[model samples]
Target: MDARRGWLRFIGRRLNPLTLAAARRGSAPFTIVRHRGRRSGTIYETPIIVARRGPDFAAELTYGQSVQWYRNIRAAGGRCELARGDEGWQIESVESLPVAEGLAAYGPPRSWVLRLLRRHEFLLLRVEGSGGDASD
Candidate 1:
């Protein structure tokens, strides 16, 4: 692993539990992306920064492209559950976009240090449900 990713994994292991708890309480921007592990088959609830745009949601890939959650979602064929703003969504299509386009979804980086620290790639999810009922 790269130095930055190594450091991020080290910190994520310690901080993610707290973040997950806060997200489960329905925090803004902080949403939950739940997917199954690729090998272990364990369900994981990952906290991520998400922005709802129309019938879609954009999620930040802050920890770079190799994060387990990202891989799991991809491995599972772009299917996952999303909980955001006190609502649940079934995501169907997940597309990885370039930094230029993805940055628009995230608004702006909070700080130069953070901008430099995290990856800019993003996953744009197409929400599959209407009327609070998910089709798949």
Candidate 2:
């Protein structure tokens, strides 16, 4: 694995459980992404930092775009489950957004220094549930 991906694996594997727990309890800046594995078909739950962007949700590709969850989301035809608090929303569209536009939608970072080290790729996940649970 690449350096950043390695680091993310090291930390995320151990800490994501707690993060997912906190996110499920309605913690700020944390949300749970539920996706199916592309090849294995096993379901996985990953915790991500999501920001509201218009009618969609924005998540930074901090460890680059090669992460399994990112790829799985795309390979699954942009369909996934997003959990915030006690509710889970279905997503239909998962596309990359330009860094500047994503940053604008996500708002100014608390640390500009950290901002400089981030990747340009960001995913904009469009919620599919409108009046019902499966309509986008």
Tens digit per residue, CA lDDT, model 1, 59-112: 767666688888999899889999855778998868875565556655655324
Residue-level lDDT tens digits of model 2 in 1-136:
8897688887787899899889989887789999999999999999988888766787888778788899999899999999989878899878777677677767766225336776577777888954322232
* Local distance difference test scores for all models: 0.75, 0.80
Query: Best candidate, TM-score-wise?
Result: 2
TM of each candidate vs. truth = 0.77, 0.84
TM-score of 2: 0.84
Cα error, candidate 1, residue 96 (Å):
1.8
Clashes per candidate, residues 3 or more apart or on different chains: 0, 0
Off by over 4 Å in 2: 1-5, 110-114, 129-136
Question: Which residue window of length 10 is worst by lDDT in model 2?
Answer: 127-136
